[model samples]
Target: MDDGQPLFRWSWVVSNWDNDSPNSIVNLLQAHIVMSAVPVIVGLLVSLPLGLLCVRWRWLYQPVSGLMNAVYALPSLALFMILLAVTGAEPVTVIIPLTFYAMAVLIPAVVDGLASVPEHVRQSAVAMGFTPLRRLVQVELPIAVPVVLAGMRVVAVSSISLVSVGALIGQGGLGNFFTDAYQRDFYTPAIAGIVLIVLLALVADGALVLLQRLLTPWMRARRSA
Candidate 1:
């Protein structure tokens, strides 16, 4: 009941959990999950092919990578605004920028992972009569899975945090909570929203880590050696 302790009180948040309309904590959390996840998935799909292309065409790597890096460096909000002009205020505007940012982080990791495959391994695959495409698919990509997954973990965490920013334009996940709290001069929702976002990021990172371990048991064995 103390007015000054609005944000710190666990009781108020618990009490408000089932409140009507858009302010429901469950609704916001669900929205946040969807907004955070979709962009990363789209980015991974696009980056995988683009990364492969960069690796295959050595000459294209520099320019392509430079472009991605530049895109990554641009502010997320700024990028969102630019996309707004063309894509309008829809979710696609947020998603496109997020996807490009994910690509920027992923492409270098993918390119490096693919390049790191031992020359001897590649030669051996060629000797065994594997075509370039077959060798890439059957051997190189398998070896690169760990590094690529590491990049994915990074992308996933970043995407989760950034999803909140979309709330600036009413497209955010838990970001709306922060905006609402600030507008209403109440901090309980803001506090809850941030906690959830961090937990979501940690959960996502942990899942990716587990996936990497499952996919590359050899790496685990090598590490334990």
Candidate 2:
């Protein structure tokens, strides 16, 4: 409407696509990908151990869950604003809060996955003389993979969405395009960025699902049987 042609024309998107400069579409997209992925990865590493600890000591679960939920409930914008003072608008400001949110989702998933294993299976492992660590690493973790991967899918998609919110702080991935378009009243970049982001989320979720299938072939076998 603003440009006389449709706002989301493919011709405009093609014209704006630049690969060489840091501000190019490709670079912005890469930045977005890195920004989204790093927090989730860090969250997974931290939350898995913490979730296991919570399982080991049931008393810790309530407190930890409460804390993470509180953190997750905090507005992302507010958290970014608060962290800006400490981190000075660096990428860490965005990554740190995103990591916290990722953990909030992941910890519960890990806990539920572990808890889903039948008590008899755990008992059998104990009877078979499996050490606590060995049972956890070899038996319990493997069985919990499907549920944990489900959580990872949730976190990954949400994180990808949230990366755009980062653009408000000048740290957004593909989200920057929306902000740019709004300010300039140009639709091509925003539309293209959104399409790419949706594709990325779909691809990420599919990969996680595939990984889940790979890790739990018995589930597939049982389904076929």
Candidate of highest TM-score: 2
Pairs with backbone N, CA or C atoms under 3 Å apart (clashes), candidate 1: 167-172
Which TM-score value belongs to model 1? 0.92
TM-score for model 2?
Answer: 0.95
lDDT of 2 by residue, 1-225 (tens): 454768677776666677565657878888888888998899999999999999999999999999999999999999989998899866788889999999999999999999988999999999999999999999999988888888999999999999888888887878888898899888888889899999999999998888888889988987999
Q: Cα lDDT of all candidates, in order? A: 0.85, 0.88
For all predicted structures, in order, the TM-scores are 0.92, 0.95
lDDT (C-alpha) at residue 139 in model 2: 90
Count of backbone collisions within predicted model 1: 1
**lDDT (C-alpha) at residue 133 in model 2:** 94
Which ranges in model 1 have alpha carbons more than 4 Å from their true place?
1-4, 15-20
Residues 1-225 of candidate 1: C-alpha lDDT, one tens digit per residue:
345564476886787677786657777787778777887888878878888989879998899999988888999999888888898877777788888888898888889999889999988999999998899889999998988888899899999999888888887878888998888787877888899899999999999989988889999899999
| Ten contiguous residues with the weakest lDDT in model 1 | 1-10
Candidate 2, which segments miss by more than 4 Å at Cα? 1-3
lDDT: worst 10-residue window of model 2: 14-23
